[model samples]
Target: MPVPTRKRSPFLTLLPWPERKALAEALRTETVGGLVLLAAAVIALVWANSPWSHSYETVRETHFGISALGLNLSVGHWTSDGLLTLFFLVAGVELKRELVVGELRTPAAAALPVVAAVCGMIVPAVLYVVVAGGGGGSLEGWAVPMATDIAFALAVLAVISTSLPSALRAFLLTLAVVDDLGAIFVIAVFFTSDLNILALLGALAGLVVFYILQRKRVRGWWWYVPLGVVTWGLMYNGGIHATVAGVAMGLILRATADDGTDGRKAEAMSPGDRTAHLLRPYSAAIAVPLFALFAAGVSVSLASLGDVFTRPEPLGVVLGLVVGKTLGIFCGTYLAARFTRARLNPDLSWADVFALSVLAGIGFTVALLIGELAFPDGAVAGHVKAAVLCGSLISAALAALLLKRRDRVYRRLCEVENRDDDADGIPDVYQQGQGEAK
Candidate 1:
């Protein structure tokens, strides 16, 4: 008997091969992710500030979910809380990978990025407080500018510098990873409300169970999915943000199986790597963009822009991202190198570090999320969002100019290194220098 083939979805079948290929590639590329995020944010801003602005607000505030279980929330809240959990889960997996085998495995390798990330967070916070101190806005927003959006920064660098070395990219990725982990901690600690001790303990109990299951080599997704949902629900009930549950789930998954035997015929992938691979595209392309669309739709006008200048909060955020971020990262990296006697890779330079430091100022995702958490349903929240957009834009433009200059230098270096006489592949200077050494 012949078996029937499963019917393909119209969505997949309708798309052209080239378009699907481009989308698959784009989902894997940080540059494309950043562009999509930017496009979403821009579209949101235009819609919010346009003639149909009230309609945008109405849609954002529309209620959804089952009210009986206290699951109902505004559209924006669902995006921020429900959708962003996926992103955080992926982040958790990445954090585990870095800790287990990546650049963060060794203290010596992790020192510079850790120090830079710490300083990068601290200086901006201090600057925010200083600029907005004693002002009309609350100081609760100190953490708003403390994040570095890795996707945006990498996108900028990728566009402007094709010859940029991988070492530099690795450094930036490490710093952002640390920065994001810190931001998660801050959210769980500082932003939670009406904490329930019993529910929190339940959440902990669930986490312990999840960890034990992984230790026992529980490999099926069917077993873990329900556990994750129950944990998330318990976390939300405990007055903790549901997103923290995702992070918890991510950290507990085994980077390597506990058993010594490499049963590859049965065990195909590590838990963390498999989970990340399954979820990263969804988190990047769907969850993040939806979050951006909802979080970024702030109505802006000339009057509001004028008012932002007057308010300490907006100015503080702008300066925090544009100036504080650059200063903090550069000084921190410089100090780490000075004290530890750690040498930078030969392909990198102080100028390159400085340029990348400025790019780190693009604090979009976490910054906007924190702004909403800090001043929910307040006028200042809108201003904070606007300031985040403006600040990130300025940083991207400045980094582009700086990186362009550096790109020229790298191109010349590449050309010189590739220069060959007598139609030989090797450069003449290299051959001549080798002859002398011999």
Candidate 2:
């Protein structure tokens, strides 16, 4: 008797090799990046609490930049304001792809996550206000918990829930994109100081030119890099966060080439996709971890950790991130399914959704950004940063516990779905599902 041979799944075989490689490489990069980011955060925490804590503070406060250009900022500010743009640029590219060709392309498919993201933002802000008593100087920090660090959340998922459905990752990515957008809007509207209209107009003009070049299929880092720097510089000078320029550049680039193409596959390989593919690794592995190293280094002695719970602002941040995020995301998703045509994937249960929601509460990167902006004074900022770390840690622990408990079910489902019982290689389960969908 001849032995049965194993082959690729029909879905995997259908995709181009380069696309498949890129997808696989991206997942690996993000998983590795998440690990690196965690290590960086841990180092920062240790350094901040060590006997040499003053050295950490001194390094963070050291200034470096062109003072003539009004660009001199501390080490921490540079991390938060400058390096973080790369992260947002990748996010912008991802958001554009989702809007154009990915899960968010349709109204119904997009509605659930978008609504969930909105509620996720709103509820956290409301909770912050209520907990912190948003009257005197406390309301500024309300936006701190409204962010979900995509790298960190995805990292956690990659570590523990490898067998989970792809839709959950899609949902999380979409949620993070919308969450970042909300944070950007909040920063631009509320946190900006000394707006310079002329510089803003210049940034707009630069974006227009960049868009035109992208339409002409202008390739090479030489052309885009200089233009990107100019745009970022202008936006920074214009009193808008420099990171917004990153998003603008990402969004302006066409997701699909305008070659009068009819096929979906051809259009899928756009400048945006290529840019994201090339830049995502650096954004995840280097830029983000460095930023975390600089931004997350706050002295969290036992006393400060205790104070974080008692202080109104830090208390609000904790509640907003841990409780408000889970409540808001779960309720929003449930409401979307209940009222709209949108429904959860059959492979996912409400338990899975709740776990994902808790995972979304890991608001590390942008949460730190907002906390810095909200309380620029170093005295209080440290406590708030401690709160963010605490809250995010709690959320991650809960999410991991819940997801691990359900790993058996997901593993069984994965094996069943990928089971190729027939002598021929393709999984009958997937073929049948696709047939039913069609």
Top candidate when judged by lDDT against the true structure: 1
Q: In candidate 1, which residue pairs clash?
A: none
RMSD of 2: 9.3
Which candidate has the top score in TM-score?
1
lDDT of 1 by residue, 1-438 (tens): 899999867873558889866776677678887888889898899899899989988999999885533587889988898888888888888888889889899888888888989999999999999989957667988999999987788888778868877888888889999999999998999999999999889889999999999877767898898888778878888988889988888888867544546753354668898888777677778888889999999878898887667789988999999999999999999988988866566778999999989999999998999888888878888999999988898999999999889888888877777764546877777889999999
Residue 400's C-alpha lDDT in candidate 2?
A: 93
Candidate 2 clashing pairs, residues 3+ apart or interchain: none
Candidate 2 C-alpha lDDT tens digits along 256-328? 6555565433444678877887777777767788889988988767789888888888989999999999999
| Clash count, one per candidate | 0, 0
Segments in model 1 whose C-alpha atoms lie over 4 Å from true places: 1-22, 67-69, 134-136, 256-268, 420-438
Whole-model lDDT values for every prediction: 0.86, 0.85
